[model samples]
Target: MQKAVGIIAEYNPFHKGHEYQIQQAKEQTGANIAIILMSGDFVQRGTPAIFAKHQRTAMALLGGADIVFELPSFYACGSAEYFSSGAVSVFNALNSIDFLCFGSESGEIDTCRFLGKLLADEPKLYKEKLRSFLKQGLSFPAARKSALAEYLKEKDIPFSEDFLDTPNNILGIEYCKSLAAQNSSIAPVTIKRIGSSYHETSLSSEYPSASAIRRELIAAWNTQKFLSDTLKNAQPPAVKDYLCALLENETFLIEDDFSLLLKYELMKNTPESLCAFSDMSPDLARRIYHHLNTFETFTQFAEQLKTKELTYTRICRALLHVLLNIPSDLPAISPAYVRLLGFKKESSSFLRILQKNSDIPIITKAADYKKLLPKEVHSLFEKDLFASNLYETVKCNKKSTAFTNDLQKPPIIL
Candidate 1:
């Protein structure tokens, strides 16, 4: 059987544990090709990815993936459902991806499937139970577990472990649901994460978590040897260079951009407008408005106010929406074209697969996007353009790349 596995990842810094997951995916699925569909400039946690798409793609290819593709930014920054949905849809289009591999604390699929069915088919009663649990002061995860227990009490469904403790497993279930909902042919596989926890700050062995790895990198300027194997194993594209680029060029400065726009938006925001920002619960928005004057930096404001139920990531996402003018829900749209990041000669086969079936243009140049897209997409394209230029500035000493349309392609820097 010929099986090709697809992965959706954000290797903010590639690590060893990630390598173990890829190895397990291939071993379990008997897959030869590992296709990674990853976030671009930003990650799921609503921060700039430690590195840009081009660098990340290069690292993914080195790590083990046979091919790398960009997950659209809209889907990349949204909820788990949208993030997984957007990624799954792209894999679905490829036609060759037969398995979807992800990391989960619980390596069991049967329990995930059961929970998924309930979440989708039994929305109202389940939601109400969950809401009731939350009103009693349970955290979201705790409330969810309590609600699930109540829903499954009459039945014999076995929740193998403390489900609330497993973040990857929760997300893994989301992936299963996405695959099933889309009716995609991809089979789901979960590799149990090893070594450190997802959000752990301390490092022990070669396979340190991404959080630990990021901290190490941020503290020290060195990368080559200092990078943990867990991250180096994944081969996240030249991250040190990227971060330096961002710092030097002031890419982190949000003035005149989304963050500034958001500051203005928040001051003028009506309760009703705040309500439209999805995760901004009615109560939370009121708190934000009441507390906006209390903090200075966005991170400071978010960290001081949020509860465990509303994670720092979720709070940052909500803030991003206010700044970027992203609507609560995004409509599905074609990529306009498949833009190449970095690919080894081996990626030729992968490109062939996409080019053969891709619905829109497959572009290697940023300049070509204007001709292919409508004016509305310009704002979206401009962000990407800025991201690309900013990313390039990080990789090279001098600014050697064009911000707008340049037909000349960047050589695949291995």
Candidate 2:
């Protein structure tokens, strides 16, 4: 049987570290193929990707992926738990994957799996403890961590809070839990994240965080400097060239890059209408409604509403959904189809196998999307189309890419 390993990612812009993971995953698993289910225009962080999805998809192929699929917007913009489970569900539905590989700060498969099992088990005491923490006003993630720690202490199982703290480690644990919940046959594997931490902001390291790279790239683009010294040194040769070329014709966007439009959406809609989207608590909605005229940018608005309890990222994501008019109930549903972004021409055999074993519809040609999926699924996909159009409107002044005409843009064949 042919073996393939799956990776879930938001190659917001592919970097050296991502390339390393792909090479390591393929070599470690000895898998014949690597399939990456990547986020589309929107990402889990609740922000638009710096470059468009097709551009990033090209980067993924250049970085060493055989196949790349879009992780529908519903999951792409969700929290870690929902995002991981949604992607895992898609991979599981394929029934052709042999292993799932991801990068983590800890890099220990056993430790990650143990935490995953505990979370999935969700013993009685853990639930009580979690509810207690939630009642105390902690964020959902914090409450879950505290509850798990207390549960472990009661069981006399020593565990470090660090396991649940770091960004990559938290995501790794979620991947394991999702696999367990689905009773998936695919094995989970981990690679130690190298160079910089996820939140690192400096581009001095060989492998800076994606955040850092984006920061430098944005600075360069803003100043009419296509590739700054920092970005040139930080990225791999091909990646640096690709990004520099992209910036020459397009813009470098941040998480709240489209905040002006978001503000318009918030100001144009009733508070009640805004409440229908995810992460919009009544209190948060009221705050947003009252502050609509106070701040000029979405980032400023988010910062104004940000508190110890309400994080900046959370605020940004919530406002983004409002701008997109995304329904709050999206997370309740599974992704409707596997949207193919791009793939290597040489991977025909692998693609054939995936199509044969896949349970969901595999979308290749964008023009045939309606014909391939049900009306309801197509409606859900329209969210993706809407997101693409919004992102492109920002680039209207810049040169056009494949993303400009996503409705008819075929998947890139490299």
> Best TM-score goes to which candidate?
2
Candidate 1 colliding pairs: 14-231, 15-230, 15-231, 16-229, 16-230, 16-231, 55-237, 367-405
TM-score of each model, in listed order:
0.80, 0.96
Model 2 residue pairs with clashes: none
Off by over 4 Å in 2: 398-403
Deviation of model 1 at 200, angstroms: 1.3
Quality of model 2 by C-alpha lDDT: 0.85
For model 1, state the Cα shift of residue 356 in Å: 1.2
Model 1 global lDDT (CA atoms, 0 to 1):
0.66
For model 1, the stretches where C-alpha displacement exceeds 4 angstroms are: 123-128, 134-140, 221-272, 276-278, 331-338, 360-363, 373-414
Error of 2 at 296 (Å): 1.1
The alpha-carbon RMSD values of the candidates against the true structure, listed in the order shown, are 4.8, 1.7
Error of 2 at 63 (Å): 0.9
